[model samples]
Target chain A: MARTQGSHSDITGPRIREAALALFARHGYAAVSMRQIAAEVGVQAGALYNYTPDKQSLLFRLMYEHMQDLIAAYADQDQTEDAAEALRQFVGFHIRFHLQRPDEVFIAYMELRNLSSDNFAQIEALRRTYENALEAILRKGQAAGAFDIADTKIATLAVIAMLNGVMTWYRAGGRLSLDEVEQAYWDMVHRSVTA
Target chain B: MARTQGSHSDITGPRIREAALALFARHGYAAVSMRQIAAEVGVQAGALYNYTPDKQSLLFRLMYEHMQDLIAAYADQDQTEDAAEALRQFVGFHIRFHLQRPDEVFIAYMELRNLSSDNFAQIEALRRTYENALEAILRKGQAAGAFDIADTKIATLAVIAMLNGVMTWYRAGGRLSLDEVEQAYWDMVHRSVTA
Candidate 1:
C-alpha cells in the first residue's frame, strides 16, 4: 500500500503503535514479533519497516510517546498555591490517566526490561522525570506543613505504587465511577502523608 | 545425558522451579521458552519435561505453590482476637512473604495472563481465597466498630495493592529492613482504615 498523506494522515503509524502496545501489554515485549504486530495492524510484515526501523524502535516509540503525552497532560494543570488542592489534582490526574490508557501504562511499566540497555536508560530517565514531578508536589506539601511524610522518597514511591496498582483492577464498567474511585484513593493518600 | 536419579534428585526439581520463576518473571511466561529455562537450570531442554509436563504447567505450579505457601503461613499465625493485632500480622506476613520470594511474587502476578483459561481460573480462585481472608479480617473489624470503611471491597483491594506494590521496588539490601518497611506500611494502613 502507498503511504497515505493528509492533514491527519499518519494513520499507519498510529495503527502500528496501538497494535504494538496491545500486544506488548498482553504477551509482553520480548514475546511479540514484528510479524505479529503487522498481522494485527492488517499490513504486510515488510510494510511495517517503513514506519519503524525495527521492533525495538517500535517499542521505544510507543513508550517515548506515552511518556511525552503523560508529561504534557500534567504540564497543562495549574500550579495551585494550595498544597492540598495540588496534591488532589496530582492524584486524580494519575488515576484517570492510567485508567484511561491502560495499554500505555502497562507497556511503560512492564516492557522496560525488554529495551536495550541504552534505550532502557532513556525510558528510565523519562520515568524519573514523571516521578520527580510527584515528589516535587509532596515536597511543596511538606514545606507548607500540610503533609507529614517521614521520607519524601519512600512516600512518593508508596503513593505512586498505590495509584498505579489501580490499573490492575479497575474496569471500564465497574461499580465505582472514576470520581468515586479517585476520592477513595485521595482519602487514603491524604491520610497517608498528613499528620 | 543420562538422567541419573541422584544427580537430579537432590536439587533438580527446585532448580527447575527457580529457573522457570526467574525466566518467567524477567521475560514473561509466553516469551520464555522451555529451552531457555533448561539452559538456566544447566540441563537439557528435554530434561525440563522430567520436572514439568509443559510451560503452562510450570507457570501454574509456581503460582499455585506460592499461594498455598501464603495461605499456610497465615494460617499458622497466633489466633489473636484483636482485629488491630490481626491486621498487623497480616501486613507483616505479606511484606515478609513478598520480599523474600520476589521471583515467585513477580511471576504469579505478571504471568497469570499467559496461563490457559482453565489454568487461569484455577489460579485466580486460589488468589480469591487469599483475598477473602484479608477481606474477612476487614469485615470483622468493621463489625466491631474498630475500622471505619465505607466499602469493604474497595478497602481490601487498596490495602492488597499497596502491599503487592512493594515487590516492584523492594531490594534485598535496601536501607529499610523488612521489619521497618512492614511497620511503615502498617502505619499507612492503620491510618487509612482505623477510626
Candidate 2:
C-alpha cells in the first residue's frame, strides 16, 4: 500500500509509539519485537523503520518523551505564592497526569533496567529534573515555614512515590472517584510535609 | 561432572531461586528464559526443571514466596500495644524488609502483569493480606482515636507506599543511615494519619 498523502508521518509516529508503549507495558521491552509492534500498529515490519530505527530507539523515545512531557507539564503550572497551594496543585496535577497514562507510567518506571547505559543516564537526568522540580517546591515551603520537611530531596522522592502508588490499584470506576482520590492523597501529602 | 551427593535439593534450590530472582528482576519474566536462568545457576536446563516445572512456575513461586515471607516477617514482629507505636513499627519494618530484598521486591511489584490470571489472583490476594494487615492497624488507631485518617484503606496504601519508597532510592551506605531513614519515614508516616 502507498503511504497516505496527508499526515503520513504524523499519524504513523503516534500510532507506533502507542503500540510500542502498550506492547512494552504488557510483555516488557526485552520480550517484545519490532514485528509484534508492527503487527499491533497494522503496519508491515519494514515499514516501522520509517518511524523508529530500532526497538531500543523506540523504548528510549517513549521514556524520554514521557519524562520531557512531565517536566513540561509541571513547568507550565502556575507557581502559586502560597507553598501549600502550590503543593496541592502539584498533587492534583501529578495524580491526574499519571492516572490517565498508566501504561506510560508503568513502562517509564519498570523498563529502566532495559535501557542502555547512555539512555539510562539520559532518562535519569530527565527524571532528576522532574524530581528537582518537586524538591524546589519543598524547599520553597520549608523556607516559607509552610512545610517542616527534614530533607527536601527525600521528600520529593517520597511524595512522587506516594503519588505513583495511585496507578497501581486505582480504577476509573473504583470505590473512590478521582477527585476523592486526589483529595485523600493531597491531604496525606500536605500533612506529611507540613509542620 | 557428577552431581554432588550432599543434599542435592537443599543445595540447588536456593541457588536456582537466587539466579531466577536476579534474572527475572533484571530482564523481566517474559524476556528471561529457562536456559539463561540455568546458565546463571551453573546447572543444565534439564536439571533446572527438577526444581520447577516451568518458567511460569518459577515466576509464580518467586512472587508467592516473597509475599509469604513478607506476611510471615510482619506477623513475627512483637505486638506493640499502642496504635502509634504499631504504625512506627510497621513503617520501619516495611522499609527495612523491602530494602534488604530489592530484587524480590522489584519482581513482586513489577512482574504482576506477566503472571497468568490464576497466578495473578493468588498474588493479589497475598498482597491484599499484607495491605490489610496495615489497614487493620489504621482501623485500630481510628478506634482508639490515635489517628485521624480520612480513609483507613487509602491511608494503609499511602503509608505502605511511602515506606516502599525507601527501597527505590535508599542504599546501604547512602547519605543517611538506615536508622535515620526509618526515623524520618516513621515521623512522616505517623503524622500523615495522626490526629
Candidate 3:
C-alpha cells in the first residue's frame, strides 16, 4: 500500500514541529535556521515550506500551541466551585502542566521577543485569555470573602510566575517529590490570597 | 589631553559590555557576534578582543558583573534586624534593582544555556549566594516564630520569582506607581511566609 498525502503530512508536520521546538529551545530562535530544522526533521529544506511559510510562523505556532494546550488542559482539570478549592486546583495544575513541558515553557518565555509585532499581539491575547481564567477565579474568591487580594491582576501574574519558577530547578528524583512540591506551593499560594 | 591606557580601557570596557548586553538581550547570545557588538560600539571587531578575550568571556563578564552588583547592592541596603522588616526590604530591593536593569535581568535568565560549564558554575554559585541571603532571612523568621514556612529555600525562590514577574509588565507610567507595585508584592510575600 502506498502512503497517502494526508498521512505523509501528518507524520512530517509533527516531526518538523518537534525538531523546531527543540532547536529553538536549545539555541535561541534567532540562531536557528530553516535548513537546520529540516535536517533535524530528516527532510529537504524545501519540504519545510510545504508546512509553514517561514521561521517567524514556526515560532508563533510553537508559542500559540503551547498557550492553547495550557488553556485546554486547565479547562479540562478544573471542576471545583468553591473558591479556595479552585485556587488549590489551579496551583497544582499550573505546576504540573508547566513542569512537564520544560522545553515549551522555556521557549514560551524566552522566544516572545522574537515574534513579529502581529504575532506578538496574537500570542499576547491568548496569554491574556489564560490569565483572565485565573483572575476570574481570584475575583470569585474575593467576592465570596475567601481571598483578600488587593489586585487580582497582579495576584494572577505573581502566582503564575511563582509556579513557573519550579521549571527552572525541578528535576526528576530531586530532593522533594512532585506531590510535596505541589503541596508546598499550594500552601504558599493559598495563604497569600486568603485572610 | 592625553588618555592613559587605564582611562581608555575604563571607557571601552563599559561600552563593550553595554553593547553586548543589549545585543544579547535583543538577539540572544548565540545569534550575536563580536563583529556586531564592536560595530554597535564604533570599534573594530579585533579591538573587542583587547577588552574581553572572546564572545564567551564577554557574555560571562556581563552576567558575573550583574550578579556581583546585585549582591553588593543587597548587602548595602539591608540594615534591619527584625526578620519581617528585612524580608520587606528584600522584596523592595529585588524589584527596584531588577526593574532598573531590564536588559541585564533578561540576559541573566535567558543566556544561561550559552555559557560554558565553568562559566555556568560560577554564575550558579553567585546566584545561590543571593538566594541564601533570602533564605537566611526566612530562617531567622522561622526561628523567631514570625514566618510559617514549610521550606525556606523553596519560599525564597518563590518570592524572588514572583517579584521578578513585575519586570515583564510594569512600566514607568503604568496604572500602578513603583511604590504601589513594591507594596503589593511585599504584601503577598509577607502573607505567604507568615501565619
Candidate 4:
C-alpha cells in the first residue's frame, strides 16, 4: 500500500521496530512480508519504509540492536575483576537478561542464515564482542590459575550456549524459580571451569 | 503445479524428505511452502502430498527422525554403565552426531515453534527422552559420588547445551580438529560437572 499524506504521523520508531521484531521472530525474516509487518504496526506498507528501508535492514537492525543491548546491559551490570565473582555474575546476568527477551534470543540464534553476508558478519562481530566479555574473564582466570579451561574461546562459546539453553525450557511457573535456575546454572558453570 | 498422471513416478519418498529438509533448513518451516518443496524435489505439488500430508507433517518427520537417529546412534555407541564414562561417551557422541547433521539439528531446535500443539508435544517428548539419557548418567554419577552436582536434571541440560554449542562455530578445517573440539568440550563438560 502506498502511503497517504501523513499516514505515519501516529507511528513512533520504537513501535515499528517492536512490531518488526515480533513478526520476524514468529514467521522469520524470509517468510514475513513488509505488508504483514505494516499490518502488525498498524501502518501503511509505504509508511513502514520510512522507518526501515527493507526487510533486510529490519532484520539486521533487530539483531544488531539485540547484541548492542546485550553488550550495554552487561556493561551496566556489576562487572568485577574477580574472575570467579565476575563469572558468577555473568551467569546470573546472562540468564536474567536473555530470559526477559525470549523472542530476541530466539531470532538472534535462529535467523542468522537469512541475513546478507555483510549483515551476518556485522552480527557475528557484535556477537564476538559480547562473547569476548566472557572470554576475557576466562583468560583472567586462566592467567591467575583460578580456572582451568582448555580453550578460552571454546569455553566462552560453550558457557554462553549453556546459559541460552535456559530460555528454551525454563517457564515462569515451572518447577524451578528464576533464582534457582540461575543458581543451578552458576553452580555448573563455576564448577566446569574451576574443576 | 498439480500432478499429471504418471508425473510422480520419478520422485521417491527419500527425495521428498531430502528436499524438504534442505528447504526448511534454508528458509525456515513457516517460510517454505509445499510447492517450493516440490520444486526442489522436481515433482508436482500434488505429487509431493502423496508422500507427506502437509508442511507440518514434513517438519515433524524431520525432527522425529533426527531425534530417533540420535537415540539410536547413542544406543549403538559404546554405552557403558559407569556414570563418568557414560557422560564422557555422551559428550563425544553428541558433538559428532550433531556436527554431521547441522541442518537437522538447526531445524529441530528452531522449527519447534511452528509445529501444531499436538505435534509439538510429541517432539518435546522425544527430546525429553533424549535428554533423559544424559540425565540418567548424571543421576548415576550423583548417586555414586562420581559427579558432584547440585541437580542432575539441570546439569544434564547444561552439559548438553554446552556440547551443542560446538555446531554453531566449529568448522572442519579450523584450528581444531573434530577430535580436538570434542576433547575441548569434553574437558569442560567433565570439569563443569565434576568440579
Ranking by DockQ: 2, 3, 4, 1
Question: Which candidate ranks first by DockQ, i.e. highest?
Answer: 2
lDDT of 2 by residue, B78-146 (tens): 988898888888888898899889999999988988899999999999999999989988999999998
The best candidate by TM-score is 2
What TM-score fits each model? 0.93, 0.94, 0.92, 0.90
* Candidate 4, B1-195: lDDT as tens digits: 344556444556898899889888887877788888888766778877777777788889999999889888888887788998998888888888899999999899888888889998988998898999999899899899998898887888888888888888998899999999888888888887885
Kept native contacts, fraction for each prediction: 0.38, 0.59, 0.62, 0.79
Worst 10 residues of 4 chain A by lDDT: A1-10
Candidate 1 local lDDT, B1-195, one digit each (tens)? 334344555688998888888888877777788888888877789878888788788888899899889888888888678887888889988888878888888878777778889988988998888899889999999999989887788888888887887887878679988777777888888877864
The DockQ assigned to candidate 2 is 0.68
| lDDT: worst 10-residue window of model 1 chain B | B1-10
Q: Give the per-residue lDDT digits (tens) of candidate 3, residues A1-195.
A: 223334377789998999999999987788888989988877778889999988899899999999999999988884789999998888888888998899999998998888889999988998899889889999999999999999998999999999888888889899999999999999999998977
**Top candidate when judged by lDDT against the true structure:** 3
Chain A accuracy as TM-score for every candidate:
0.92, 0.92, 0.92, 0.92
Task: Report per-candidate DockQ.
Answer: 0.55, 0.68, 0.66, 0.64
Interface RMSD of each: 1.7, 1.3, 1.2, 1.7
Q: Report the Cα lDDT for residue B52, model 2.
A: 87
| Model 3: per-residue Cα lDDT over B23-131, one tens digit each | 9988888878888988888777887888987889999999999999999999988478899999998998999999999999999998998899999999999999999
Q: Where is model 3 chain B poorest over a 10-residue stretch in terms of lDDT? A: B1-10
